[model samples]
Target chain A: MRKKRMINKFTLYISLVILTFIFLFPLVWMLVSSLKNEFQIFRDMQSLQAFLPPAPADVEGGYFHNYVAAFQRVDLLRYIVNSLIYTIGIIIFGLIVNSMAGYALARFRFPLAGFWLGVIIATLIIPPESIFLPLYVLVYDLGWVNTYTGLIVPFIANAFAIFLFRQFFLDFPKELEEAAKIDGCSQIGIFFRIIVPLSKPVFATVAIVLFINHWNDFLWPLVVASDESMRTIQIGLQYFMNEPPIKWGQVMAALTVATIPMLLIFAFLQRYYVQGLTHTGSKN
Target chain B: MKGNDSSAEKLENERHFHQTAKKPQLKPTPPPRKKRKLKSQAFREAMTGYFFLAPALVLLGVFLLYPMGAAFYYSFTDFYILTPDDVSFIGLENFKYIVEDAQFRQAFWNTVYFSVIVVPVQLSVALGLALLINKKLRFRVFFRTAFFSPVVMSLVVVSILWTFMYNPNEGLINQLLQTVGIPPQPFLTSPDQAMNSIIVMSVWQGAGFQMMIFLAGLQNIPNHLYEAADIDGASSWQKFWHITLPGLRNIALFIFITISIAAFKLLVQPMIMTQGGPLGTTKSLVYHIYETGFNYRDVGYASAMAVVFTVIVLVITIIQRVLIKEERG
Candidate 1:
């Protein structure tokens, strides 16, 4: 019986290692292929060499060749900046606006608070993708189309962010607020000074969720940022890929650049990001 | 089992957390007084509350709520994007037009098919992985990160990478198949295989997210229950059925409804990789709606589809919530 269980454990470990390899293969493939020229990439495709970096002889440029070419071929820096501006803007403003509302709903005796909470939660069901057409029309009517305003403003007040903040603040220890009040700190001041500082984890979770989400935002940016100057990294990459004579190396390079931030985020903030994901989730 | 009472109680607490709102308000308001100073203080507090709420409320009202109402209204009218001024309310005409639209019908059914297949498969894979990692395994964090790396990459990036890999002529997938003694099969090029190809990629990209949630849910289950089951000589399958499955029911329900809702909005993959494909087999409802609304500028038709899409999501969510409530009762 002991020997039989030992075999089961061995098999389990072997299968898990295989599963891990399968999951990591594409991402590994992307990084490997990006280092080679187009010819070398295709030539190595049939063999296991496809997953390895090119030797010095393979490409005129070194291992970092494609990344350099990616920038020259496309204005990657411009789009990266544009995407960062939009994402950071949304996160900063969203945290303030949503957290205040959440604090109000959780602690204040605001009139119609229940009604508004219900409405906000209901809006969670109607994702932006569903009602985007009319929303676009509204943006168009406001003459904000193809502009930063169109990209950023509509998303600054997220229902999910508000919902999350409210849930977090619901369990917030009120004794801190009362003690702060005794010290003559205003409610708004207490929120900024006390609540925001103590609630870093929840803030990290929301910010990471928004950062990853808006960073990857494709469709909305696709439609809104029609002009070349306004294009986000995803939109720029799509255009770059489809615009004839597709260079596999450069495309891989662009994809790698686009993906690096998220990997960095995952590396540093895995717990908070995971918290964002499991919304109907564990507190721990 | 010995641990049954505590495990059952733990599940009850979870269900209660799901059903109830946050606990009572924290502010301890004194009884109302006719005194002028106290009345003014009450008024000031109410004003501060309103002040805090105003910005988010305005934005949500204008951006989200207004657009939703506008979409419903626009669905009934011939609200052309080109000629916004010339609008006529044509009740159910847009809906009628879409029902007769061959493309929309195909897209609708295709979405339903994708959801029905993808949701269960992705979720089960996620649950299985969660179970694996939840065990006392070495390199748990490393394995979790490896699985989740795909989810970290954007859909556009994934779609592009897969498009290259899915290429029939010289793609890596076909090339690998050839080495493995299997013939190269057309992936995105063949209409029948295109949806299946998309489904495979979709499941791979998405399973990690649900896996995290499942892991969280798994951690919530009491370890004592498993020990008790083992003490009682319960088989692994029996323990899974009696302890694990029951523990994960709520998380499973949440993952199911949420995944299904997201599945219905399948757009970017088909739009980028297949361009709705060799025979338009991969054109999802959202893709078609975008093509119509933006590409064709037929606002009325797309708005109708949007209404239907929202209704579908709303119905699923409501039904799930009510079912949970009923199950709790």
Candidate 2:
């Protein structure tokens, strides 16, 4: 029995290690390929050498040139700045607005609160694509085309965020607010000082989710930002490969740089990501 | 004389009793005012809710809802970029064209086929991985992050990376296959393999999310059921097949439907990797809508297609919900 158990454990470990490799392979390959020279990357597709391959004497200087060319061609710095401005703008506004709405739905005993919650949750089912056409017309009519407002306005209040916040606030101990009221604190005062401060995990979760969505959003930005000057990194990178003579090296370099910020952000805030997801999953 | 004084005191007491009766009247007045104040307070709370929701509502209405309505109206019109004044009602014609158009039909079928093949494969792999990591394994967090990292990377980045990875000449995939003496296969290059290649990349990127969902589901299952199974000498397979499978049913259904819907909207990979080509084999309905609206500037026809696509998605969602709800019932 002991020997049999040992074999089962060994099999489980072996299978797990193999599966881990399979899952991690592409990301690993991409990272290594990002460091290798064009020729080396193309030469040994299977070999581990393809990633960070040893360079011949002549190829020593090409790597920096690739990155520089990538930055120059697309104005990557501007794209990053554009992404940051848009993402940060949405997150700050989205968090405050969503939390306020959520708090009301959870705490207040207003007529039609349940109805309003239902309506908002129903919107979650209507895929955003279904509404894209009307939104474009509205933006055009308002002369918001090619503007920051056009990109940011429609997404400022997310249903998921509101729903998540409301759920979180529902379980929030009433004693905290009651104590504040006894101390002669107003509702708004207690909210700002007490409620918001206590909800750090959910706040972090919302920030990560909102920032990632806005940062990676390609379709909306594609429609809104027609000018090269306003183009986001996602859409900006596409211009490189859209031309007849595609520059693979430069495209890879640009993609590498664009993806780094997201990876770093997600890596740091992953615990929050899982936390928010758990809240949603469990509620449902 | 004393009896006369007692009578005077009684008369004074009667007068005081009359004033005491008036005190009850004041209580009724305060009740109405208190009710009015509560009503006003409720109204104020409602207004605050609206204020909080206003920003999101305006944008959602303008960009999302307006576009949806326009797509419906424009679908029936003969809209052209060149002559805005020449627009005319062409009811059912656009729909007729979609039904008759070979490429449109092919794209529609391809999307359906892709969804059918990809959703299950992706979700199953995700569940498998989730189960694996749900065990108390070493480096579980590292493994989880590694699996999900690709999901954070943009489609443009993943496509570019995978395009190289799928390169028939020097791609890692082909090199691995060559080691097993299997001839190098054209992945994205071949029309036959292009969609499959896209699916592989998509599944790799997407499975991590479903895996996370499955992990949550797995944790929710009661360990006592497995413990009971062990007492009965039930094999691991039996426990998984009976308890684990039944426990994960709702999550599996949810993931399946979500993945199906997401896969149906396949646009980015084909656009970036193949440009819907190696012969129009990779063009999806959403991409077609984009091409028509942007490339050709045939807003009217594109709107028609968009409306059709939206209806199809809605129908699918409803069907999925109904089916799953029935099963649960």
Using TM-score as the measure, the top candidate is: 1
- Each candidate: fraction of true contacts kept? 0.72, 0.47
Q: Clashing residue pairs in candidate 1, if any?
A: none
CA RMSD of each candidate after superposition: 9.3, 8.8
Query: What level of docking quality does candidate 2 show?
Result: medium
Scored by lDDT, model 1 comes in at 0.89
Q: In candidate 1, which residue ranges exceed 4 Å CA deviation?
A: A56-59, A282-284, B1-37
What is the CA-based DockQ of model 2? Answer: 0.50
Tens-digit per-residue lDDT, A19-116, candidate 2:
77777777766665555566766665656565453455646665466688777776889988888877888998888878888887888776677877
Query: How would you encode candidate 2's per-residue C-alpha lDDT over B32-57 as one tens digit per residue?
Result: 78889988988887676666556656
TM-score of chain A of each: 0.95, 0.91
Worst 10 residues of 1 chain B by lDDT: B19-28
